[model samples]
Target: MKIATYNVNGVNGRLPVLLRWLDEAAPDIVCLQELKAPQEKFPEQAITDAGYNAIWHGQKSWNGVAILSRGLEIEEVMRGLPGDEEDTQSRYIEAKIAGLRVGCLYLPNGNPAPGPKLDYKMGWFERLKAHSAELLQLDEPVVLTGDYNVMPTELDVYKPERWVDDALFRPEVREAFHSLVAQGWTDAIRKLYPDQKIYTFWDYFRNAYGRDAGLRIDHFLLSPHLDKRLLAAGVNREVRGWEKTSDHAPVWIELTAGG
Candidate 1:
């Protein structure tokens, strides 16, 4: 089976591009981030017409996430990160589909370091760590995939020195991501292409994509069992060149059956 993740940026504005990609790639399951729409605004019919059943968590003009499955029942597990009750951003959604536990998340961007945004980012990371430990204890095949908003290593960034102080590449943020993976999750893409420089996102300004200046922020972290089933992984790089497409390209992984 194939699973993919994409940050649509704005589901409504990019609906055409999204449908086109869905038609071309035909992944069995897809995780979408950055819907940037309210709950009622989700284009359910349009997505349904594309032959997928979906469940989504949406917030107005900001973060959102969804899971879509083709020809499989999507049994929703949860909608938000479990650690905080006061936290209400639509950044996470988990579901059980085809015997796999899938988590789709849009982690906080936490821009402008030395401020509250960075603080919130760290706090969210801590919550994620706590919740992730519980998931690990279940000993199930779990795939946590999405736009994490942090580049875990210099290797994941196009220009490490230029982004050293930026929120996404700050030393602490990278450490947090590293520590999270230390909890026994395999970074799937990195596992497959150890030394390769594969990127999933590119900036709109400065001709980032044209110049191949990009960041590998979208990822798939598989539980030990799922890691063993991993067969192939790659980015739909050409999709990034599509007109009005998101800054993020679709990233996917194929797994052996019977997980």
Candidate 2:
């Protein structure tokens, strides 16, 4: 089955573009980020009309995430990251679909480093690491899919030096990402297309999309215990051109059944 992720930016603003892609790509499952809408305000009719079942964790005008599957069953696992009872960012949600546990996230974009935002980003990542380790210990098929808002290596960013001082490219952020990956998780896209410059997101400013100035921040990291079923991975770049569409494109992967 095909599983995909897309940061729609705003569910209400880009609903049309998102629906068009859903019809064209027809992935078995899709995780969405940056809904920027509240739970009661989500456009339920549009998604239901597309023949998908979905669940969301949302707030207003900022971060949100959801999972949509075509007739596939999902068991709710978690809503937010651990380690902070008072934190209210709608950035994480986990669910189980057909025995595969999936963690959908929209990690913080801690811009303007050397500030409180950067500190929060680091602390959030630490919590993620701890929770991820627990998931790994479950020893089941687990896929961590999300817009991580991080570039772990120079190869993942188009202009590495230009982003050196940026939160996404800072040393600490990259190191934390490395620590997560080192725990026997395979970066599906990188593993599938090593040495190839493939990007899943581009900025809306200064012609970043048209000029091909993009970053490979979206990821599907599978635990080593679930790698046997690895099938295919790809980025649906065509959808990025839709009217009022998100800067981020759709990334997907397929896995074999009972491998």
lDDT of 1 at 48: 98
How well is each residue in 124-191 modelled by candidate 2, as lDDT tens digits?
Answer: 99998998899999969888999999998898898898999999999999999999999879999988
Q: Of the candidates shown, which would achieve the greatest lDDT relative to the real structure?
A: 1
Best by TM-score: 1
Please report how far candidate 1 places residue 227 from its true position, in Å.
Answer: 1.2
lDDT for 105 (candidate 1): 93
Task: TM-score each candidate.
Answer: 0.99, 0.98
> Each candidate's root-mean-square deviation in Å?
0.7, 0.9
| Angstrom error at residue 237, model 2 | 1.0
lDDT of each: 0.94, 0.90
Query: What number of backbone clashes does candidate 2 have, counting pairs of residues 3 or more apart or in separate chains?
Result: 0
